[model samples]
Target: MAKPVLLNNITHQHLRVRTGPGAEFGDNQMAAPIIAAEFRQAQAHYPIVFRPTAGDGFEALALFGLAAGDNLFLSNDGWDADYVPLAVRRQPFLIGVSGQELTVHVDEDSARLRCGPDEGEAVFLEEGSPTPYLEQVNSMLFALHEGMLEMTGLIAALREHALLEAFVFEIELADGSERRLEGLYTINEEALAALDAAALDRLHRAGYLLPVYMVVASLSNFRALIERENRRYAVPR
Candidate 1:
């Protein structure tokens, strides 16, 4: 749970956040929600796909590993990938909404939080003000909040046009085993292409076309994910 970080929280001691990936910090999440703002860059690294939500709605995620509880990018040296998802980058700290305003919430039990210095990122200065690190987190939170609003609107537009279709991913592993991912959804290129001029205009007016194509383009990165897995296979066990 997050207690509202206030002057008392900072003045008494320090908010030290251990930087890097670790089980204690909860970076072990295999998939994370991402937005249109990140899709272009995320496409370069991970395969961005949409997963069905409980209410038949769709949400986008960046797939990190072939199996559950696996994150191929994580290592002793921190995240091995060149680009980390925005949701992953903003760990321990989350955005809270009070009516129309947003507040920053820090998970007290997070491994990122440390009472004192043991080689960790400080959330606040000794003088009780935001540090550069905390400032960056704030920026990320704001960007995420804004980006997600756009993402939600675009997804609704896709749904309006019936452009999303359920998909299944099948991979034949190096050991001759098969891995399957289901309950995922992707844009139907044919459906998108079949859109009438007026329908296309509506999507364009909502700034949805770019992101729709970005999600489609990201599927190619699945090959790169398999390559990452194959590297581990090359090592003598």
Candidate 2:
């Protein structure tokens, strides 16, 4: 449960957010929900996979690690990946809808909220206006909100075409131990290739073909993910 409160300049005038990547800020996540709008960028670093929702719908995700709570991309320096998914970037803040208007909400209990003065990026100016950091978070929240809307269409297209398939990943670690990942779903390339001409045209017209292909391209990152796991375990920590 998040302690969400509507962002107010007066009530939260002294807010300062810690923007750096660290496990303390809850960046130790194995996967995060991703929208189709960012597939091109996110696919470059993370494996784009689908997971089934409780309502039987599917949600796209950017996989960060092989095991639960394992984020191999995070290091003492910072996030290793060039492209951090928007979902991961937008932390401690969320967008809320009130009728037709959108509002910003912050998690009061988040570790990213700086406890010491002059410790992190300021959220507001001296006169109570939003700082550059807050402005950036606002933009990111809007993008995420819009991206979620776009994902509805993309998921619809995938469902209509029967393009998603469940899969299980069986990995042999460096220590000869086996790890089996289950309940993950991915694009079915065979079915995609076998689609009829009209189906392909429909997908293309809907602007979903590129993201579909992007999902396929992202699967290559799984090999790199395995390598990362191997390296993490090889180190004498």
Candidate 3:
């Protein structure tokens, strides 16, 4: 249950957020939602893939682990990856929409919130001004909001070209145990390649060509993910 409330500096001036990566803060996710804006950098780290959403839509995700409730990048020292997805970084905070206005909302039930003076970074100054941390959160929220809108356009373009296909991932562990992953979708490279000049121009003009290629390149990171899993199980290569 999310207890979201409008963020106000006056009422929440004393609030502190215990930042840093940890399982208690809900960082132990196998995959996290991503946006087109993240593809360029995320491709170099996590395997970016598409998952089917309700109806005919699709949502992009950055795979973090092979199994449920696992995040190989998370450790006591913090996230192992150089780039943590904005979706993961913007925890316990959400953007709210009212008419044409966008508002910041905080999840009051999140463990990240602290009232102690020495516990974490303050969300606001004693004089009721936004802290640098809070400003960063605001930037993240706005970026996410804009990214979501871009995703809709990107997905629509892909769907228009019939460029998404479902596939299964089957891998064998060092112990000879097999794991099969399903319900995932990826770009149909063949279809993309076969697109005529006009269709290709449309996607390119929409500024989606680069991210599409980034997603394709990101599939190679599956090898890195396998290596991480093997290491987790202490399986020698």
* Per-model TM-score versus the true fold: 0.90, 0.96, 0.95
Alpha carbon lDDT of each predicted model: 0.81, 0.90, 0.90
Model 3 residue 16 CA deviation in Å:
0.5
Hey, what RMSD does candidate 3 come out at?
A: 1.6
Between which residue pairs do clashes occur in model 3? none
- The superposed Cα distance between candidate 2 and the true structure at residue 76, in angstroms, equals 0.9
Question: Given candidate 2, what's the lDDT at residue 36?
Answer: 83
Each model's backbone clash number: 0, 0, 0
TM-score of 1: 0.90
Q: After superposition, how far is residue 71 of candidate 3 from its true place, in Å?
A: 0.9
* Candidate 1 RMSD computed on C-alpha atoms after optimal superposition onto the true structure: 2.4
What would the per-residue lDDT of candidate 1 be over residues 69-113, giving only the tens digit for each residue? Answer: 878777777887777887988887888787888888877766677
Instruction: Give residue 64's error in model 3 in angstroms.
Output: 0.4
Worst 10 residues of 1 by lDDT: 4-13
lDDT of 2 by residue, 1-237 (tens): 579899999988999888889998899999999888889999999899999887777889999999899898999999999989877788889999999999999999898886699798888999999998999999999999998888888988898888988999999999787778899999999999999999999999989999999999999999999999898669585
Query: How big is the positional error of residue 132 in model 2, measured in Å on the Cα after superposition?
Result: 1.7
